[model samples]
Target: MKRYGHGLVLGKFYPPHAGHHHLVRTAADRCERLTVLVCAASVESLSLEDRVAWMREVHPGVRVVGTVDDIPVDVNDPAVWDAHMAVFRAAVPGRVDAVFTSEAYGEELGRRFGAESVCVDPGRSVFPVSGTAVRKDPVGCWDFLEPPVRAALARRVVVLGAESTGTTTMAWALAEHYRRRGGVWARTRYVPEYGREFSEHKLTALRTLHPGASWEEVTFASKEFPLIARRQAQLEEEAARAGSPVVFCDTDAFATTIWHERYMGGLYPAAHEPRRQHLWLLTDHTGVGFEDDGLRDGEHLRPWMTGRFREELARTGRRTVELTGPHERRLATAVAAVDALIGEGWDLADPLPETP
Candidate 1:
């Protein structure tokens, strides 16, 4: 088997760390020569010249080249990128055999063209990131990203709901409460759960009828669906492990499941008697303001549906905690509940005794 990459393995070796170092060392061992391409030179943000300088300092004899002035910097204007690459490759008479990359599509693109692409994975499973524990705070993206990309996610939280229901107002109040209590708040990004995006799509899209399909067919399809149904326990576990003292999840996963069935006509069991355990019913939405998200069937549907959300929760055989009262009262109630749980030493580790 005559493998072409006994020669150069190429990549944009940006700020080479343990991962990059691992990839380059592995590639260098397998191949006779390696061409680390410093692409996106003219595009700014850590110039190609600087990258080459860093690589030269570290890699010593390893060959690296800059394509700053050579290639079309405007990749967003995709029409010119391919043409630009061709001219750039032609212009750089300096040799290269393959494009060395870790990204999946990058490998495919290289294979399609004349060049070969190498997948130099860092074996992420073994050496979990040093930055991971920091990410649990739900604050800075520093925990989620490498240094360069970490700076991109500067954020602020906005809350929304009905006027007296205290959406934006509660947001500020909570921020203050968290600050005074010496608590690190997971800034809440809440909006009315009217689910506008889903609503708009439903207007034209044919609604899957309730009377039409058998339970088995719908249940089977939902089970086989690619996106895994995220369990509530998993979320709780993450919040705890992240060491976040108080997690303010907007409507929880149970709420999500109920809403899916209620609004979008999502899957629900035909027989309600054999109920799932460890669920909460939406009860006492007496003061809850009902707002229309354009595609809402009408105002009348709100009251009927509000009651049903709770009934369905009870049907699941899950314990119900009905959130009630005015804006200040409800917000205070929620805070009180979290404080009470923390006081009682609510161990999130305990699995919901039964599934809802």
Candidate 2:
């Protein structure tokens, strides 16, 4: 139990998990100061900046830095080891009292750094997880991941369309369907349409002065779309962080762009941003009656809005499925699409091989 003045913990940390956090915590506890170097390759799916940000958020006390290390890992080859050491030394560049790791190569890594080798959970019995396992099956290893990692990996499915096309109902039903699967899926969440809420507030405020103002009287300024879009994005992000492997959104920021076009008669670039949704389920207005809920005055414009949504979704190259027919039928189609998406799985590329 010898404490070191400066300890080093380096890894690809493609996506930091509970096991990686445990190793860092153990190293931090034993060392006066710890430096966690995250080495990522250019071909990796996750960005070096994102991995560094995650590590810094998780272990704020430890100095977390990231560098691109494209050198292939061959632990037994001295030449490969020297090449890697060069990259590591350049990133650290300071005295290293110890090298902490959970792999068998700790001894050589420490020797190269001219410091003690401290191995934590070399057998993988403590956390029982690895970066490869997590990448291969993120849903199965969901519990081993942190909120930020979960948010990044979650398959965000957005259900959106014109006013009163069963978007809200389908979003809730999809969430419930997933929740029935139990385990991590039991925590499946649905993000409501923030634009509708904003409209309600605006209508309510307008009524306070006139006391008899209707939805038609409540006008929307072009500037309001951006605020609503931002709030919708924020809500989706929060739900994705806390929900299950997939999150169902009644409407998302992408939908806001279309809504802006509908209301403002033109595209508002400020109201839209590139979203990371895996799939978009557009609830078709066909055979679905529009019900005005005191805040909706676009019943007549449903068809136009639906067409606009279709045009935008297609032009943007977003993967989308139009839900038609009865509620039960639409729900069934949506469920199948979501199941297929989940079955496809996260295709995270494997990191550089490290031979023991």
Candidate 3:
């Protein structure tokens, strides 16, 4: 028994907090057809794509659309309303029987289409959260944000260098450092080296399935490098989505690209295509000794590998910080760099680079 034939929920959804979700969901419940308009401006940090994605993810049944316009948020000005209504009509199309909002403008906006107004929590009593508050202190308002929004807001730091340059050690230390900050920054997460996971899986397959597989046999299997890159990418993205504000990745696809050159004889295009956003903490091979995990190429190969990392970093023009010295000193340097990057407004346009 729907009250309205069609419903429309429009918002800036700057970060798309829980309050916006409630309003949208409630409207969808009361209407047979619901459409959410995620209106954003160029000045906002969160992209229109992210806003639409979050809404659709959280409310799968409802139609979501994103539009970028510089229309001032002044409903008192009829000119502003006219411009907004134009954009709304373009985005939605067809007819709207109800306009849902938590603001007084709901009635006036609805009147544009001769639709009924559905206002909920105009006083903010139901969901005591606002977009402005969330923007000012996302960590403070973590509970108000959906997982996708939180994930979008989460900062990712990648540690990369030759094998055993204290990448894993520094990654965990960084996560612990943020975790100790506590409250909103409390649940820091560190992604382990996925190359190791790939190697282990291959070794298992060789033992059981192949029985007597050679290194060349496994390396030339055609699926090996791509699978590793894809799996590593998948793990990094999942960790980024659910991890704390500062998600520390032991190594990323860029590092995998470097490894692919060494182990797989050539670079795979997909491995090198990760969009450059992470503050790359390149672990210096100066003082740190390389430890041979059974999968390691060789101790001597590290300096060469480290050179390759430098080459790739230079080639990609990544935002990088070199970590050197003892474990504590290296961690301190990495932390400082990360803090500086954060201050400079480091964030993602989207959660991931275009990965195949």
Please write out the lDDT profile of model 2 over residues 239-303, one tens digit for every residue: 99999999999999888888888888987868256677999999999899879788778888999
* lDDT of candidate 1 at residue 74, scale 0 to 100: 45
Off by over 4 Å in 1: 1-180, 183-243, 264-266, 269-283, 293-295, 317-319, 346-356
**Per-model C-alpha lDDT, please?**
0.43, 0.92, 0.79
Best by TM-score: 2
Q: What tens digits encode model 3's per-residue C-alpha lDDT throughout 173-223?
A: 999998898876777888888888777777777778777664435553445
Off by over 4 Å in 2: 269-271
TM-score of each: 0.35, 0.98, 0.89
Q: Which of candidates 1 and 2 is the stronger one according to TM-score?
A: 2
Q: If both were scored by lDDT, which would come out higher, candidate 2 or candidate 3? A: 2
Q: How many clashing pairs does model 2 include? A: 0
Task: Name every residue pair that clashes in candidate 2.
Answer: none
- The stretch of ten residues in a row with the least summed lDDT in candidate 1 is 346-355
lDDT tens digits, residues 1-356, model 1?
32444334444443334455556666676666766655543334445665676666556657766664434334344555476556446534555566555544455446534566667663454224322233232232223333322222222122322122334355445545664654334432222223333333344343355433332232223331111124332433343334233333333434444444543466643222212122221324366665543433335555555666657555755545555676666566655644554354312121112111
